[model samples]
Target: MLPRPVVPAAATTGALLLLAACAPTVPVTAAPYATDPVCAAVVLATPDSLGDGLDRVATDAQATTAWGEPRDAVVLRCGVEPLGPTTERCESVTTPNGPTIDWVIVEDDGDWTFTTYGREPAVQLLVPGAVAESRSTSFVDALGPAVARTEQLRQCL
Candidate 1:
């Protein structure tokens, strides 16, 4: 048998330790703020409790957040350009008297896409079909109150 190249014991130990320390850390890309100040405050006031099954992913933006690590299932983007005078249906969500926020919801292939209406510099959330089934209200409800601090005055009627 050909003699195996002997790797030093010390070298093997160092390799193992290096591999252990090199675990991947996924960093979420932050969404642009559209240069709005209100969006910044909402991010600061965001609630820490997002409920079970959803994890707050590490993000680059103060106003952007993802619900999964490495891969995002639910993404929240604040300060998107607001839609003006659209025929799309709007639903008013009742909050704990913070600020009334209306949502323009679109569902396709089980995926739920939500954008804040009756507000300037809208906030958008993309909820995957699978995630929406398990955690429909929990994620949106928690973020609503926080984002409501922006104080949208327009009504969705």
Candidate 2:
């Protein structure tokens, strides 16, 4: 009986990496959606340079998109019915490029849900509380234009 020689682990790992890089693109199914289809186009047309730590994800809905991992993700839902008059902490932010977005903050223990305040077919973003406090400005700064394209039927006074 003869024993076989083993290849070095480093070379084996490199081979795996090369194989993975050559793998075919996997299809991501859309999430179940009940909102307007136009919102999907807005989402699909959004650039990938959203931010430093976020990555676009495929869901089953036309009006919904998600970023980051499923466990703790930032979910954006467009074409939602806008919020009516409320007494919550509604804030307006002007992006660096000069677009203003209105948002109503819904705070939970470790999550902050922000919904566009005065836009038709509003946008709702569910971000982790930590990310909301830290990178929210950056995210909103980038997201303003895209969301604004949907048209505003109202404005925060």
Candidate 3:
């Protein structure tokens, strides 16, 4: 009979701790105004999960967050440059029993990028096609409160 090898409890715990600490960090570029104090408030107010099993992930940049797998993560970056009047499609997303936010939509390669229209230190969300098709406005709704931390200066008209 072969003897079973014993692993030390402390060593096993240390290995588990190391693995837990090694969660992948989502790479995101910090926005030009990422250091703005309002960005912190927005980040702090963001929900831990965006429904549909999409949970917040660690980001490499300030005022940035991601949910779900890196390849198809819903990324949000606070402190993006505020938008001015534009002819692009703008949608006013009103969360259920929550705040209303205006987002200017830009599409590229079947992906949608939504940026806040009226808020200074604006926030931007990159939604992959699959998630957009599956989740629709849930992501935006989940983020409404966080993005609304900054006052709205205008509305989609």
lDDT (tens digit, per residue) of candidate 2 on 135-157: 75457656777777666777776
lDDT of 3: 0.89
lDDT of each: 0.70, 0.70, 0.89
Q: On lDDT, who's better, 2 or 3?
A: 3
- After superposition on all C-alphas, the RMSD of every candidate to the true structure, in Å, is 8.0, 7.9, 3.8
Off by over 4 Å in 2: 1-34, 133-137
Q: Who wins the TM-score comparison?
A: 3
Give the distance in Å from residue 140's predicted Cα in candidate 1 to where it truly belongs: 1.6
Worst 10-residue lDDT window for candidate 2 reads 25-34
Clashing pairs in 2: 30-59, 30-60, 31-59, 31-60, 31-61, 32-60
- Angstrom error of the Cα, residue 85, model 2: value is 0.7
Model 3 misplacement above 4 A: 1-17
On lDDT, the stronger of 1 and 3 is: 3
lDDT of 3 at 84: 92
Residue 77 lDDT, candidate 2, scale 0-100: 76
